[model samples]
Target: MLVDNHCHLDFPDFAAELDAIVARARAAGVSRMVTISTYVRRFATYRAIAERYHGVFCTVGTHPHQAAEEPDVTAEELVELSRHPRCIAIGEAGLDYHYDRSPRDMQQAVFRTHIAAARATGLPLVIHARAADDDMIAILREEMEKGTFGAVLHCFSSGPELARAGLDLGLYVSFSGILTFKRSEDLRAIAADVPLDRLLVETDAPYLAPVPHRGQRNEPAYVAHTAAVLAEVKGVSPAAIARVTTENFERLFAKAVAAEAEAGAA
Candidate 1:
């Protein structure tokens, strides 16, 4: 089985036919998926998806692109929302200098808020860093000193230095469908260096679909293609990559699995 460690199933692309989307993911060997939250104001929409599908899980966060819109979202509010049994992680939050959709300072502030929430709740943070490697690395280092927190450098396409920094901080690194692109040879080199136990795979679906499916709407089901690419880069069988990454997902999101099991028993 494969676990897509990050995706956005609640997006409009799947809203009208979410059941079929989930079924297709399962049929494609995607046994589990983590639906990412972008805007806190619409988190309930994300939560509803998780509630409806046994294999679906979610996070509560404000993406950097939406940071300006949610400037007042306090760490306490994030911590409170994180108490939901279905909410497994703290963010899809971080710096995004690529677009600068939000003010840099505001994005940093919100990222710090999410780091606090992750620390408070003991859940892994899902980071979305882009074109702000130095700042992201510096903030992550500072926060690590203040307190320990779990985090994943989601959809990593950064330089090897940032990857090393994140791994040094004992955080996991997740590869998205972007890894499957032929132009991602440098990225693949970085993937090869990352230890299997610290690695994860995701679709970031409704977004970066892997090759053969590139330029199309991505889904959790396409993770297998990324996995195949990662396996090739790491010189391991796709099954091995699947097992390692799935184990990493369970370990990093331990609370989510436990919460889901408890809900089942209830």
Candidate 2:
């Protein structure tokens, strides 16, 4: 089965037909999805979505863009919220200098909080690095020295340098619909170089739809297209990519997988 390692089912865009969207994903072989949290204040919305769908999981953290708005976020707060059985990861948090949506220092501060939470809880952090790759890499490197944390560079669009930094630091790299773009040859090259165990695929739904669906809203169901392209780039069948990446997902998010395994065993 396929899995959209990351998505935002809690967003307003899918509110009207959330059920149908999830159903479509199941039909497309997407067995599970992680509905990402962008704002800590509305984490309940994400929790509700995860509760309603067995195949859906969720993360708890603030996005970089919302840093200023969530200035009081603390590592302890994220760790506390992550106690929920449905919360499998610590963040969609990191640097995003591309938009300057929040002050750079604020973004860095919030990102550090997320790193701390991930380290404390032993959960994988869902990272989002944008144009400020150098700063992002620098912070990640410094943080690694302080204490290592499990993390994945979600929807990676940064240059080779950043990808190398992430890989060297022992963070997994996830590809999105962006890999299907014709001009993403360089991205594909980078994808090719990522170790098999460290590779992942995501749709980043309601955004960055693949080539055939470019400029349109994306969904977890479309992760297959991205996976197909990734398989092509890696010179393997789509099914191989599916199996390996799904295994990688389970390995990285150990607590979630262990819970699911126990349930099945029972």
Note the Cα lDDT for every prediction shown: 0.93, 0.92
Q: Could you give the C-alpha RMSD of every candidate to the true structure, in order shown?
A: 0.8, 1.0
What candidate 2 gets wrong by more than 4 Å, as runs, is: none
Best by lDDT: 1
TM-score of each: 0.98, 0.98
lDDT tens digits, residues 151-252, model 1? 999999999999999999999999999898989989999999999999999999899999989999998899999999999999999999999998999999
lDDT of 2 at 57: 92
Instruction: Provide the global lDDT of candidate 2 against the true structure.
Output: 0.92
Name the 10 consecutive residues with the lowest summed lDDT in model 2.
255-264
The digit string of per-residue lDDT tens for model 2 on 35-117 reads: 99999988998899988997789999999999999989999999999998889999889989899899999999999999999
Q: How many residue pairs clash in each candidate?
A: 0, 0
RMSD (CA, angstroms), candidate 1: 0.8
Error of 1 at 258 (Å): 0.2
